[model samples]
Target: MKRKLLFGERMLLGDGTEPFNAVIPFRLHGIFKEEEIRYALGRLQEKHPWLKALIQYDEQHIPWFQVPEATVSIPIRLVNRENEDDWQEESKQEWHSTFDYQTKPLIRFVWIKGEVVSDMLFVFHHCLCDGGSAMALLYEFLKVLDNPNAEIGLENPILGIEDVVPAHILQSGKKQFKAKTIGRLAALAIKCIPVGRKVIDRQTDYLIHWKFDKKTSEQLISYCKSRGITVNTFLGATVLEAFRKVRGAAAFNKVSCPVDIRRFAPQIKDDHIFAFGLMIVMSLNQKLNFMDNLRLMQTEVERKTAKLNPYITMMVMESAHDALKNFTRLLKRGKSSNDCMFSNLGRIQIPDQYRTFSLETVFSPSVIGPLGNTTTMVTSTFRGQMDFSFMGSEGYLPQAEALAIRDEIIGRIRQQLDYKTAS
Candidate 1:
């Protein structure tokens, strides 16, 4: 079976040139056989049909997910475990490597083999899945790897716009007319607006990862709870403050946070391999204090989230398909107004102990898109420790500044927690 790509998916596919990939890297403790890992992936492929499908373009130049009769397995690349930082280096390389979507599966695995401890990187074309979907896949992979008899179960995914939006809505003449009118106006505006002609070279992309111990992580959670806010809201405020401190007050205070559409779209299960992104931009109020700024940001988050109509957004984007190239051009123009993209996956729910192997740590998933600004910070917690992976290119943000920003974010969070405790 085959289905046409959604507008979001097509944007991720780009012009089939640069690699737009998402990677989830984690460390495992115990002896794991290569054959067992391979077998686990095979089982996963059987459960998730998209893992075996390839992207094929039709004559109209639109992409489609085509499942072939022959079974296809996700390719795994094994590398000798050198040191703790090997995954980071490999992740940087993966960012530049383009996928041959027609020949191979959109997803691939890289195993850094070690005797006692090993690190594995699950890389996927951003068009195939989001971080949430990737995490679900990771959970199943570990489950089957520990016990080959384990049942991961199959997922019934909503394949197209027809599934997401009701037939009545799509077929409504009034709705269609409004959607087309808005789409054409937006497309015209996009064409009329002049963007930068020069492209900023993204040189030397780097990844910085660090984790806070159980004590600090717990304190952070307590602090957020006491403040009547979430960890995501607090982190958003902290990220904005860090940029202001490092990049000057004149720097943009905006941070784009991707909201998991599964919360709103029940048809898209957690196990479904889908790439549609729903995002809300949060900006700090420079006039207010840190705590005040955080509260305001949280309020805005609540309001924006409550008002987010996924169906309408999906419909509008699909209608604006003709203007996708202009949207891509705007992104590639290297004139982003946002400071960075901050994604907090919250506490990872995957089990730590398997019958055969134990999950030592789950590093935050990192992804760098070909879009101009590559400054992104991804956070997740596993086994009571909060882990972070900060990825950026020197062209967008200098390496030294990126390190300073990372330190500032951590320090700011700790400062808030410590101050609250002292009071």
Candidate 2:
């Protein structure tokens, strides 16, 4: 479809801040002919409204999908099948993929026809869909490829921004809710408790990604389970341990690990597909031994993971939005309080068969972050291996040192396992 950019797409163009997006891979075995593939793409476009449309207007990053309601209807690109040369040149332009900002959602495919191999990639705005939505997208495209006559029937489409109320409006009993939310954070920042000297870091930053074989990732998971510690905590503790070795013990003692708030609730929807997490920092006032720290960390991770609530996180995000929109003070303050951040998407299930083919080792993509000195870590377990990727600015933490830190932590985990066996 031919059209001007959608409002959400334009916001990204203006701000130059693409939300970190995900990439999906698919393998094809000879099924539908090449002519059939092209026909399927055209047919699929008519079936899925999202495939043919773009955002009408955007408030912040939220979008209101508009259907033009007029003489001319805007159309979106249906296929993003690019060759290897294109991805090579494109990768150079996205130098920030290593560290500057989050990845804009995109899919890169490796398709081979006869003796010729073709590499195709597609990028989408994160505001448009999450990982689950991407899964749905894959099927939509597949349906078109499988049968040009297939109909688009969405079990549940991506939620419109209207589905969620802006946080500013407190329901009848929400006034007190707002007060408590603000009160807790306010006390943390302004209270008599001395968190520590706040350092205004003014350093340029960068981030890069790494991958481990599927076997190693799986082994790590099994090892963690044997220890009765969550894989995330095991990996998280590894980071803290590495920092303690490099930045010194004092640094590691005070760091907080990120906790995803989804599993904490009894009936959380798999599609509540938004970000919600908290970091639980430890007190460094006292000394800690290596073994002691690990035991303590295991306990902390379990407790905090259980206590998180999505409702509260959603409420806080809305409150922050209201603060920025209404109060000049918060607008000037920039980002809400969040020091270092980490997230892990356990294991994404790959389809058993795709066009009569299967996935090889899934290539892990790196996440980009704000240039501010903030540190962020992301992990995904594919097959039996757990892959860890790090993002940080060169100004705050050198890439050379960051890689060394990762290695040392992995070594420590292994060392601990050895010590137990000898006994």
Candidate 3:
């Protein structure tokens, strides 16, 4: 089974040299046998064809996911867990490790072995899946790991662009003309745009993680609800404020948020391995108070999200394949304008208890690639606690500064909650 790579997937695949990886780490508290893990992985591969497929390039250098006659099992690397923080170190290591897409599957599993507790890491190339798909896979993995006979449903994978966009839209000559015209114009703009001759030196990348206890998490959620703003918008405002406070004049005052394409396109299921995403850029009003700014930001987020046309965006992108080199060059050389990309996976609904092992907790996933700015903040709530993973490079944001920003975020959240309580 095989399918041509989508435009976004091709861009992420890059020369297959740099690693664009995402890591999902969770702690399981119980004894787990290697065979059981392998069994679960095998079931997953059988369910999702992409998990067993490798990448191959045609004469035109276009990439396609090709499945061999004998599918290879997903590789598992077991490491003895030396300390509680070992997963963080391993996650950083995985960020730089490139997948040999030509010979191996784009996904791998890392088992941090322990006496009775194990931290399992699911590391996959970003091109293979998004956070939504990862969560679905994780949910299924836990189910099958508990019971090898668990009947987790198989995925009806998206084959190509036609599967995502409606047939009517694709067949329309007027829309095709618009897509081609816009794509060409955008490609021309990219070529004409002037960028720095030298790319920003993202010296050393690092991940900073922290958690808010249940009480604080609930209070923040209540605060946002009372103010008629989403937790995402509230956190987005908080992070932007933290950057502005920490970096002072250096802050860009803009935060980019990636919206899941599944929300716009119902044809893409939760379990499908796909990575196309729409983005919305947000900024706070300097003149307004924090609460007022959140309301404004929420309004902006909704407006921007509503206006997102994933179908047309995908069409325009697919039409501009010839200009991908120039677009990539601009991303590599362009001066940074955004503060950071902030993503909130919201609450993970997977149960903590299983028949064999009890899930201790889930860490907010982290991802990094050869892209221009390596600054990203991801938040997710599990078991009533909100977890955060803030990743950045030393060249873009020093470790000390990242720590300060983390502290600033926590402090701001506490302050807001306290004020709301007082009132």
By lDDT, the best candidate is 3
TM-scores, each model vs. reference: 0.97, 0.65, 0.99
Candidate order, TM-score descending: 3, 1, 2
Model 2 earns a TM-score of 0.65
lDDT of 2 by residue, 1-423 (tens): 222332233323334342343333333434335565556544544444444444443455643443332312112222333552333333223433421112211222223332232232333334334444454455566655655556755333234322333344335357547745774575344333333233334244444455666655656666777777777666666676677677663353444465544355323234332323445654322377665655777787667666664455544544443233223222222332332456666775654345533333333333333322356666766656665656665545666777777788778867866676566
Best candidate (score: TM-score): 3
User: C-alpha displacement of 334 in model 3, angstroms?
Assistant: 1.0
| Model 1 stretches with alpha carbons more than 4 Å out | none
Ranking of all candidate structures by their lDDT, best first: 3, 1, 2
Worst 10 residues of 3 by lDDT: 327-336
Provide the lDDT at 325 for model 1.
Answer: 92
Per-residue error at 115 for model 2, in Å? Answer: 5.9
Give the alpha-carbon lDDT of every model: 0.89, 0.46, 0.93
Q: What tens digits encode model 3's per-residue C-alpha lDDT throughout 93-204?
A: 9999999988899999999999999999999999999999999999999999998898998888889999999999987898899999999999999999999888788999
Residue 13 alpha-carbon offset, candidate 1, angstroms: 0.4
- How many residue pairs clash in all the candidates, one count each? 0, 19, 0
Q: Give the CA lDDT, 0 to 100, for residue 420 in model 1.
A: 86
User: How high is the lDDT of residue 8 in model 1?
Assistant: 89
> lDDT for model 2, on a 0 to 1 scale?
0.46
